[model samples]
Target: MATIGRFVVSVVGAGEGHNGRRTAAVARALAFISALIAFAIAGLMIFDAVRVVNEPIEPDQVDFRLVTGVMLVIMAAIVAPLGVLNLIGARLLGRRKPRGRTSVLTGSLLGAVVAFMVGADAPVVVWVSVIVLFIVTAVAAALPGTKRWVRGAPSPSESGELVLGGVG
Candidate 1:
């Protein structure tokens, strides 16, 4: 049933119509590149995290667990709230629009790149996950007619950057 519906929507140009399909194509291309970086970083972080947890620590050095544990907690705290909001924004897509969230996500993504380049200590995986999700969240949150979507007041969707209003 869902497949049938999707087919119908696809025929009719549901999301972006042909543009959406094209966007998907481009997104996939981008994702192919991004997912590699993401997975590689994640793999490295996992190694670091596991090492921190199981490795013996010197009496003079800070406990890796303490640091990693702190990182996980902090990551959870930050991601959880945004996750909820992103979910809500997702639900609102096509129902009511808000300013675009993509910019926020884009910023976070850039930040993530910088963060990873900056250091390897702590859990980089969590941060990368959040930023990736931030990109997703921002894009999702900007879906047309979503409460959180921000394209600015428009007579039409023809031209303009998706924008994020002041509030999330």
Candidate 2:
């Protein structure tokens, strides 16, 4: 049990003292990439849904087409919001705000949930990629390094003195 706890802590990078700035940068990048990928996927889903809806359907196939198109639209709706959340999180992280980490983490978890919910409908590769991306993003945001960085810790400078009084 203790070993498990230790491993979990290490995985989350708790206790600080690591290369926070770099870790935060990595987290920010991951979030942005995840957002872009999600947006792309959502756009594709929407396009496909529109195509399905516009297709000339036989009388017997009308229900099937409508159901499929609606499901696609619903999935796209779910995915797009997560992408927006991730985008917002990335922007906030760029500005060095602590809430950015929370936003990224939240977005990641929600995205994972959405991926799982729609797993059967999506291709294996697509769902797997989404899951992996969200998990990595969440882990990055949860890292102690990212936490420290987002909290605005001073970086080590050449003389080890905190630099103050810069641009107005």
Best by lDDT: 2
Q: What is the per-residue lDDT of model 1 for residues 1-168, given as tens digits with 9 covering 90 to 100?
A: 999988755543345524333333222233333434444544555565566677787899776696885564444344333333333333332222332134233433553554454334547776566456536534432333222123332433333445466322
lDDT of 2 by residue, 61-153 (tens): 435777889989998998999999999999988777877888999998898888788766778987898899899999888887888777764
Off by over 4 Å in 1: 1-62, 97-168
lDDT scores of the candidates, listed in order = 0.43, 0.83
**Candidate 1 local accuracy as lDDT?**
0.43
TM-score (all chains, Cα) for each model: 0.34, 0.76
RMSD (CA, Å), candidate 2 to true, equals 5.5
